[model samples]
Target: MDKIKISNLEVFCNHGVFKEENVLGQKFLVSAILYLDTREAGLTDNLEKSIHYGEICKYIENFMKKHTFKLIETAAEKISMNLLLNWDNLEQIDLEIKKPWAPIGIPIENVAVEISRKWHTAYIACGSNIGDKKKHLDDSIYALNQRETCRITKVSDFILTQPYGDVVQDDFLNGCLELKTILNPKELLTCLHEIENAEHRERIVKWGPRTLDLDIIFYDDLILADDDLIIPHIEMHKRDFVLKPLAQIIPYKRNPVNHKMVIEMLYDLQK
Candidate 1:
């Protein structure tokens, strides 16, 4: 993680709640700390090896001027997302949008909204036991990639596996995918649930059969447990259907909780 800083680049933009402010644009100061690996650029002494700060400055100015939003918060968020998506080498961004000409009666210097945004890698397990299993899995992958915020980076070969729970059901088509997304853990979970619902998934029993099942097995080496969802998926290590496919794509990925790689977990389950 290396840093490239841009300070107090001023721009005139029409972003405010008041109508007058929108009609007559105001001055705003933009700043950013871009996170990326600059080693190659430094060693090679080539501008192509790293993001060009001059080009980035131009992009930020153009973005700020072209969009009209009511809040600096919105401006900051949109800018961060655009910068990250547009720059392949950019890993993270710390952005700040300062509004100096506020309508507030107080003598405050300025108001600003600052935020940090980045891409996150997540592992998702997909299972389908009913109605055109392979088709269901393929469709789910397509749906996930349809979103601009999410991309399916890698996929494991779908394997036929026996049902996990006591409920007698047909063999399931199970697999795993590596997802690169800007969504947070909860947001990503919501996206998964939406995809499941679209595939007519029902949760009538504890381990009931379903048209589609999408679970978040891992989120960026994160350990999380909430009332609704858990990261590293509570029982992922014990299930071969999950570990087997996961191992195919990211065998060396370690569980943040147990510190076991995917291959080791699968070996343990088989043992």
Candidate 2:
């Protein structure tokens, strides 16, 4: 990844905890480092291939002047998200907001907040065994794509698979999808849960039956285990239904926990 830096672009805005501070604007210095691939832009001498710093500066100025927030942290977070969303080629951003004038009634050089935000690649497994199985799966995908913080990159064809667990239920329609999102692991899980709830997914039966079942298969090669969720799906490497659809799209994607690719897992399961 390459970097484009913008430093100390000053803006006069009303952002403070004090009432008078909001009435009388204060000076703020904003800086940013944008991460993206600039090699093609350099080789082709095309501005379109790269992010424009001049335009970004203007955007920052306008954003600061237009929005009023009590905390600089909120401003930084909003700015970072907006920049990444607006610029299709931008992969990550480091943003900082500095306030030179403080209402704390103390001698201070400056007060600032800095944050780094980036897009993460995640793989999800979709399954449904109850009524309207295919529609449940499709609707789940649609719901995720409708979110501004998430984008569906690729989807595997849904395949019929025997249900897992000893619940003795109907066959399930299963598939996998690749997602690009700004949400973290927990936040992503919450979003998925919301979609499942919308489809009337029941927790009464464990693998017995469901309208929709959405699981996080992999999240940026992350290995996580908590009370609520586990990464690499815990048993993904041992499940044919999971590996089969996953292999169709990203056979080479390695499991962080087992250090095995999706294709390798599928082969091992078959044997």
Error of 2 at 59 (Å): 1.1
Task: Looking at model 1, report the run of 10 residues with the lowest lDDT sum.
Answer: 200-209
TM-score of each: 0.94, 0.98
Q: Give the TM-score of candidate 1.
A: 0.94
Regions of candidate 1 where Cα sits further than 4 Å from its true position: none
Full-model lDDT for every candidate: 0.93, 0.94
Alpha-carbon deviation at 2 in model 1, angstroms: 1.6
lDDT of 2 by residue, 1-271 (tens): 9999999999999998888878999999999999999999999999999999999999999999998999999999999999989999999999999999977889999999999999999999999999999999999999999999999999999999999999989999999999999999999999999999999998997777999999999999899999999997998877899999999999999988879889998999999
Total backbone collisions for each predicted model: 0, 0
Which residue pairs overlap in candidate 2's backbone? none
| The candidate that achieves the highest lDDT relative to the unseen native structure | 2
Candidate 2: regions farther than 4 A off: none
